[model samples]
Target chain A: MKKTLVILFVIIGFNAFSQTANQILLNTYNKFSKVKTFKNKVHVDFNIPSINIDTITGKSYYKAPLKFKFKFKGIAFLPKDNPFLIYNFIKDSTKYIAVLNGTEKVQKQNCIIINVIPKEEGDVMMAKFWINPNTNCPLKMQITSKSNGVILIENFYGKYANLCLPDKTIFTIDMKKFKVPKMVSADINSKSTKSKDSSTKTIGTIIFNFSNYIVNTVINDKIFTDK
Target chain B: MWQLTKIELFKIFSKPRSYIGFSAVTAIAIVIQIALYADGKSYWDFLIQSLDESFQIENLTFNGNMVCFILLQALIVQMPLLVALVSGDAISGEAAAGTIRSLLTKPVSRSKILWAKLLANEIYTFLLVLWLGILAWVVSLAIFGSGDLVVLKSDSLTIIRGADSAWRFIAAFGIAFLSLSVVVTLALLLSVFSENSIAPIIITMSVIILFTIIGTFDLPVFNQLKPFLFTTHMIIWRNLFDNPLPTEQIFVSIGVLVLHIVLFLAITFYHFKRKDITQ
Candidate 1:
């Protein structure tokens, strides 16, 4: 009878362990939902072969759901959950239809591969992703846009374990042909990498340091409702 | 000389294309200002938030009104290019248009005609700069209301009071005009080498872009070269936004830019006079 009881408890414990992974993710996401306001610092580094662009240090603030503000030095670029992004996503949702490519392990985490045909026809090519089964996160994002062309964004899970956020994200993009407006005021000029030729074979690296991780801080009431 | 200059000025203002650049300036400024205004709160919050991390202080308020400041910031970088578009063409376009030969028939020396064109271009550039100042400052304040001018640079944030903004703009505009005049001179010099006005404009702008890219390379080689670049001087107008205005560096930038103008004009005059205009 004792042996039977032990076997039942073991089976129950394995089932509970398997269930906790999804449960933990849901809880973390729920905590995120409860977070009304918080602030964090970001150090953005662009790596190009020939350019040693200056490091941009900035702060980011979010007030739930759709509002995200990024202040770099003193100028600001805000990308929020406006209708534009939502509408574009909704409209392009059909375009994201993918043909099964193949499977590969991204940072030892298994991911499904799919090729996407971008709804908007341009130099940029598109690829799609369905999350890896082991880690319920974005497995792959690839674009074929040249200059504004195809880029691939893939996330690895090893860095921030149980963080519910993708740990290591890599963006593979073609820089030589990327075309942005000459006058769009962003840090474009400051982020170019140096080119290496026969005369110069040296590659340069820039390290960005970020600290002071404050989470779930109380925010002013007006910030969320002001705009 | 005065009569010749008046004639040249007349020719410039009468052309329909002269107004296109101005229209573009106003249209672009208005579009961007409106876009920024519609999306300002989040923008301001982002700026403030970025500043919040490096800065220990709390409740940092932009003493300057947001709209006016954004207008000025936009103008500072772009005005020079717009000014260059017209000013660069004043000499080269005249040459390309085959009007230089008729103008030269007035018994005035080629050098004198060149000088008149240069003077006319400077006046036109100054006027454009003034227009930008008025449109950016007066119109912006009218639309957005008056406050302090807060300028954010890579390393620091500058705050200028509402009362002091006008004079600072005047100084800034002066510097901007002077910097563009150098581009004008460079384009005119390129004009002497080529009959195609568009080619000179393209070449001049390319040179400016190349130099600007080089200036930002942040290499030991570029560090020495940065001080000499006219593009470096172009932004010196921003010093007025600085609380303790870096006057020495501003003057030095102005002097170097003026020297470049002199050198370019001299070269253009020499080349224009020596070239056989038989074609």
Candidate 2:
């Protein structure tokens, strides 16, 4: 009887934590779901060790759900992932199980950390979020996907915090960690070799600053269709 | 001095061999442009294939700027040989044809005659580089249109905007003129010693090839010798395309090339003044 009582307490405590995580995600989702569409002017600054590109200005378009596209004036090296797709994943609680990890300080705010794993097999394998419980805004995110590997994003909200939209977003990509075809085959003697070429993996950061955001506006589906 | 140089220029143009440099440069530039036009996309795909997995590289267009850069790299290597063909034959060909004795017997001093020939050779080298500039830069722009230049080295890739590229091209051509001028003086110096036109031309080419080989490999012994090689400095023009241009390195290369021109001219003048021409 004592052992059964102990087991019952453990189940109740675990359920409480899971419910708390679920409630936090639901509030964050509700904050963002109000926007049916948005058109924003984006200014991107690329900071990569290997690449030499500086700043490029573009327009970012978003429709209901997860459609996002960027149109830059010239050649740009950028991430392929849809930036808004993370919200889509979290909003549907049936698709993923969220566990409250703990609290961590992000952008001077004590943010709640939640780890999410998809209940079904899909492109997204796992995701983690650092959410500001007070504002229901995601201050930081780590998304692991089948196509893009591990992408770490930090969102800084200002005038758009009420809508849970970031005024600035920093996307960091580690090229070597991608689960894609390798650039070159590893040399047979690479293990013992002291000399190596400089073409090895490196980190690339793309900082996107958004302004003149027109939300809940009409967006034609033509731009979202792949050419 | 200008009149003497004009006569020497006339002599250079009269020879059929002088046209070879101009013709070769034009033909090679056009051929490269044609090949690129037909299927440059595949070539670009292969070059950026490694980076594609990590980046969605938007608007890497194959345009005039890229074509011109490619042409410059290809044509610059063979330009010295073309220059050597004309400047190499300046004195030795006159000697081989028994015209040097008559040419020397003219009222001009040996120093004045040599200087005139040097001036003419310099002019020819300048025109050839200019012709390459026209075909490689101006013509390619006409054919392919304009866009940013994406230069892919062994380990790095640089994207130079179309707006910022004009000055770099002009600077590279100016440097190419300086580089080819070194070949002119070296060939003339060799000409002063040889009785036949072919020897100086052949010897100058051999030296260029030898130095190029030494500069290419980074062996410990060769590293010590690289700074002295004109071939090593000839590639300094490429630094213009780099972000945060290495101004010091460019100046050092220009200084080295100018020194080579002075040294070769001094030896050619000294040897020609005392030579027994009656033989």
Candidate 3:
């Protein structure tokens, strides 16, 4: 009779802790989910070893669910994973299991770290988010996806904190297969690429900064589809 | 010495071989431009295929600057051969014709004669490089219009602005001129050794081919030897287009080419001064 009582108590405590985790995640996701559509001027600063690219600025559009597009004048190196995909996954409680992994301070803000495991197998195998409980805004996210091995992102929020819009989101990606193409040039003395190691990967970073947010506004669907 | 150089210049231009480099450069440049005009977009698509998944690339075009850059790359390799033809025959041609004996008996010092010949060969090489520049860059601009120059390496590609390419092209051609001059000096040195003109030209080409082959491979032994080869520095002209241009490397290549020219000239002068003239 004593052992049965202890087991029952243990199950109740575990269920309570899980419910609290779900509440925290839901609260955080709700902060940013209010907007049906948003358009903002995005400035991109990219860095990758062996790649030389200039700073580019453009307009970024986001529609509810999963519709994001960058309309830039020139070329840009963007991360493979959608930045807002985690929001949709977090909002849909049935698609994933969110567990409270206790609290830790990230950049002096006390954050509640949650370990997310997707119920269904997809691009995102596992993800961890550090959300500031005070503001209900995410401070950092580390996602491991199928295509890109490991992506670490740091989010910084300023005036847009109420809307959960980040002033800047820095993404550090270690791409396993950012393949460099080889063309058959007519030059006779061109070196053979036999020496280049294909197995080795490179780390690249993209700093996405946003300002002048016009949220809950009607954005043309053509902006996403237009080439 | 100036008058003698002028006479040597006359001799060079009078030969049918002198026009070969110019005509060949013109024909090759035009052919490459035509091919690019027909189907360059596909080539670009192939090059950026790997990056397509990660990037939304826009405003990319195969413009005149790119065509010129491609022409320069293709032609630089063969420029040395064209230059070697005339330069190798400068001394040995006279010997083969039995004019070298009587010419050496003149009142002028052997050093002056060698200088005059070297000066004449340098002029011919300069003209060839100029011809290449006109056909590759100037004419290309006239045909295709101007845009960014996209330079591709074995593993990477750099996009240089259209406005910025003019200085880089000029600097590249200047370095290219210096590089070809090294070939002229080397051929002249070989010419000093052989009595027959054909031998020197063939030998100079053989050396260039051998070094280029070694540089093309990635073997341990070849890598060790690459830094010492003149051919290793020959392509450094492309460095002008590299972002954060490798200034020290460019200077080193220029210095090495200059040293080679001076050393080869000294040796040629020394050997020819004491050489026995017999037909």
Candidate 4:
């Protein structure tokens, strides 16, 4: 009778800790979703080791519920979907299972690590978030997707700590594993006769430094539409 | 010899057909420039789609050097036809007009007249290429302005600075001239076997088209045979744009093209020297 009681208490303790971890994740998601809109002056730097590409800069405007506009002075390349999609996924608990893995220190701050597994079949297979326990903000996120490979993002929060906004975001991508159309790759291969081996294994990194961010600004929806 | 060449040049320039090549080149260049100017952004987007996820390229200008490179790639394929039009008619046209008999009746040897005709044809080929350069490269600079040249190949994207690009263009054009020389020689050799000017022109074009098809066919048998085709060497000019230019391969391609030209000219000389004019 004594042994049975001890085992039951241990099981209850494990369940209670798991519930507390889920509650913490929910709080962090709510804090990030509070920002309605923002406009930022951004400078993007790219470092592609295999293919020599220089750094680039641009301006970004973002609104709540998936509105993002990026304008560059000249030719620019970006992913098809907005970067903020990760945040949107976190805010909604219906489509994903978020579990608290453990705790770690990021930049001398104690952080709670959460592993998010999508419920429905999608491009993103898994996403791991490292959240600062004090501010309920994300310090780093590593997303592994089915088509685009792995994307590791590290966020730096400065004076916008209260608003839960990042001053800089660094993205490192595994380009070789990214799923592009076979036709595009074939076309490029046919024309290029050099560096055939190196191009297939390229890894690229992009750093975005955000400045003069105006949070909760009223932005027209027309600005996000393609001209 | 100079007088014979001059007469050949005069005969070539007097015909209205000579201007056709120049006019075609100019029109094609202008049309392409206009098209690119109007809808270049969509083309740019299509090209950079693979790199879009990683890089944010900005301030990339569609400058004259880049335009010239594009024009050269598009125009090189049609240049053989232009070369064949004039050189193919050099001997056969004279035969059709009964001028060969009159010219052979003179004290000069048949080989000398052949050499003069070949020299005149070479000069004409040079002028045609120069005119193409003026319209495609020089005029494009006037319109689009000068900047770094961006060359997109199947596997690589190369950007050549404005200061460094001129010498590469010069080398490319020189290599292009050598390639065209092979076409001219082949046409001239074909001209010797026919009495009708149209027949030689058509035959030369047919041979080029056939060879090009064989060279570009992506089959094991064709790939093995491609090295023997003179048409395969014609695109050796593209090597100029490659970083750390493959000097040995470029030289080999040049050697092959030159060998083809020499063989064609030698065969023409051997047959012409032995043929009886009276028959």
Highest DockQ model number:
2
Q: Model 4, which residues run further than 4 Å from truth?
A: A1-150, A153-171, A174-227, B154-156
- The most accurate candidate by TM-score is 2
Query: Candidate 2 — which residues are off by over 4 angstroms?
Result: A177-199, A217-227
Residue-wise lDDT of candidate 4 within B1-279, one digit each (tens)? Answer: 999999999998997777777778888999989987886656766775666555445446788888899889878878888889999999989888878889988899999999998999899989989988898899989988897677666545655657778999988888888988998898899888888889989999999899887865577787788889898888888777766678998999999989998999998888777766652
Query: TM-score: which is higher, 1 or 3?
Result: 3
- Tell me how much of the true interface, by contacts, candidate 1 captures: 0.01
Model 1 interface CAPRI class = incorrect
True-structure RMSD, every candidate: 14.9, 4.0, 4.5, 7.2
Q: How do all the candidates rank in terms of lDDT, highest first?
A: 2, 3, 4, 1
* Candidate chain B TM-scores, in order: 0.88, 0.97, 0.97, 0.96
Q: B1-279, model 1: which lDDT tens digit per residue?
A: 888778778877887767776887798778967776677656665654532322222223433244655666666566656656766677668768887677678777888888888777777777787777777767766766665555554323455545667788777777778888888788778877877768877788788888878865778888788888888877777677666777898889889999998899888988898987753
Please provide, for model 3 over A1-227, each residue's C-alpha lDDT reduced to its tens digit, 9 standing for 90 to 100. Answer: 99999999989988788777778789988988997899999999878655576777898999987898887765567877668878898897788888889899998999999898999999889999899988988899999888767889899998889978888999988743433434354434445555466666667789999999999999989988897
Docking quality (DockQ) of candidate 2: 0.33
iRMS (Å) per candidate: 12.5, 7.3, 3.6, 5.9
Give lDDT per model, in order: 0.59, 0.86, 0.85, 0.79
Better of 1 and 3 by DockQ: 3
lDDT of 4 by residue, A1-227 (tens): 99999999988987686566666667876786788899888887656543433345667898986888887644443444577778777766778777778889987888999888989999889999899888988899889987677888888999787767889888877764233342432321122243546446566677788889899989888878853
**Candidate 2 residue lDDT tens string, A47-75:** 86546765788888998687888887677
